[model samples]
Target: MARQNTVHAAAAVLVVVPTYNERENLATLAPRILAQGEQFHLLVVDDDSPDGTGPLADELAAADPRVRVLHRASKGGLGPAYIAGLTTGMKRGFDYLVTMDADHSHDPADLPRLLAATHDARADVALGSRWTAGGSTRGWPLRRRVLSRGGSAYVRLVLGVDLRDATAGFKCIRASALAALEIDTIGSSGYAFNIELNYRATLRGFRIVEVPIVFTERITGASKMSGRIVAEALLRVPALRTTSLRPLADVRPLADARPT
Candidate 1:
């Protein structure tokens, strides 16, 4: 059995926020993320936001030891930003790494539920789902809802993933699951990245679980869900399902053990 302190110390859950020009949202969202008690670390990966979100992240990090910032030169999409954060988290030896939007679409309060699902429910990857029972969406336009539901259904059929909110950005992923992946091989960006990660995990036999979360439209900042992102996801879903290459490692069984 793993030592209690090992599990507790390794249990550094950092909320990874990939940002680009999210100045409006960052100001408000950062505080909310920090307010999720002191259990989580907030990692704000700014793609050198011309809107000054990077400096804001620095300012926030300086104020809070639990907060940190990673700066990238240009807007390389959400996938790269997350990869950067994941790499840093792995190097620093954290046990759990979470990815969510800085735009407030993913609530900070839901963080604890996702964490509990991972620790108590024995899930390798706990997803915050809006399509599951007790889950819902608020303040979204009809077109957005239709697009999301249709895209999710299409991916489910094509990729054969059983997840309800496969495209959702809110997730609590164990570092062990991430270490099992050849993340360097993941080539998709934006929405496609989400599907690719989940698909690869399923292929490696990870114990993924969904926790219901109410999805809400961002109260500030312009939405970044572009047509290109959607199109890329639609295309990548089929390609990933056909790949037979095994992952770098298989840690699904570790997810079976209760979090110490």
Candidate 2:
């Protein structure tokens, strides 16, 4: 379903980018995203970066009516920041909600493809995968590559999910899926949070399709991956397995979920 230019759709798509000390990257990332299409909007969730990313985001938002900002008091975990941004998007009633990295890792150019993939398949979730067919990562060292691909494999193995890139951070999820997820109840953070969302989507009978994307490593800033985050992911994966995740009933179809 790829196209020459951006795939035009009437439904509002909110791209929620979580930022912390990403001032340099955010300055360049915003315009490229807003250029994709008029229907595509951006919500920058800033975690009170010492580098003044919050103010920069405010500047961008002030310049463009489509851009909006949500400022948090401190640097919370990635999962919570995303939850806050996505929760805001949901409350504002966006038809599609996207989770993208701000470090220039997830290409702004791929935004249209993701939107098209989800739209054409009528999927509730569009996973911008690095392990799926035609998907790959760039500017990554062998060790980092091993960790990322291996982590995805491990999550699939332990969770019994068919997702190829289970630990992937870039995704487009419909608000209907978010509503079923019960935004306030989800607590998983970082890579584990991505895994949990995809897992829950499957349980809720949401059709999730993987779209190929070349994930480039960020050159402007330091990596956020820590031993503590890794350990947390290891511990949380199993807890999700043991815990009861009762599927929601009386579920609506894709057509019904779309905004009129």
Candidate 3:
């Protein structure tokens, strides 16, 4: 899909933050996202968090017009939660959609910078990458860093994707580019979902740009990573190399609209 001719400053941008049990983080994260700029709106997708994050998201939505919450009946995994949020944001006429972590690992302060890069670079997708030049991580042990770097390398070698950080979660995607993707057909559910989406974007010939970012470890909340998630990524990467993807199409652009 070619870049839309509309001016990005006037575009409606929706930031989708997927949360499991992030009540403590949302309290601080929500306000920071809203403070980014007037063009930004926030969508918190909660998977029936046991820690009351869902109701807290409701409260935030009630308090601010720029904030909205999507409640899931059960924990369906990260990929489904994000897909639901992105579909809702697109249906409501957002020109751009951002996906990020709610645990503060992906900084809200970098939100504007990511959005700007997508527009300035005329990129269909802009990834906040830790492996790229000037990008780094904080509060991680050497083993964790090695695992992350190794995972990226493995995905690159198997999938032949050029992105430095193929599994990066922080991203700014043009709505048209997203609509072109067969999101309903994506099979990966864990962190591998990030890699699949990036790969699909590349397959469709979308211009993807990497924006250097400092990924911070979450201070609160338990980590969601598990052996099962790791196993899923390991099995899914090689499978994706041979999988045939659907062709891209130019979907209708969001009405030159803004949230009231």
lDDT at 145, model 1: 88
Q: Which portions of model 1 show Cα errors greater than 4 Å?
A: 1-10, 245-260
lDDT of 3 by residue, 1-260 (tens): 01222334587899999999999999999998877777889999999999999999999999989999999999998888889999999899998999999899999888777776666556688889998878999999999999999999998898777767879989999999999887878898888889899889988877777888999999999999999999999999999977666443221111211122
Q: Per-candidate TM vs. native?
A: 0.89, 0.91, 0.91
Candidate 2 lDDT over 33-73, as tens digits, reads 98888878999999999999999999999999999999999
RMSD of each: 4.5, 4.1, 6.4
Arrange candidates, best TM-score first. Answer: 2, 3, 1
lDDT of 2: 0.82
Error of 1 at 148 (Å): 0.8
Q: Residue 144: error of model 3 in Å?
A: 0.8
- As a whole number from 0 to 100, the lDDT of residue 235 in candidate 3 is 97
Give the Cα lDDT of each candidate: 0.80, 0.82, 0.85
| Top lDDT prediction, candidate number | 3
Clashing residue pairs in all predictions, respectively, total: 0, 0, 0
lDDT score at residue 17, model 2, on the 0-100 scale:
95
Best TM-score goes to which candidate?
A: 2
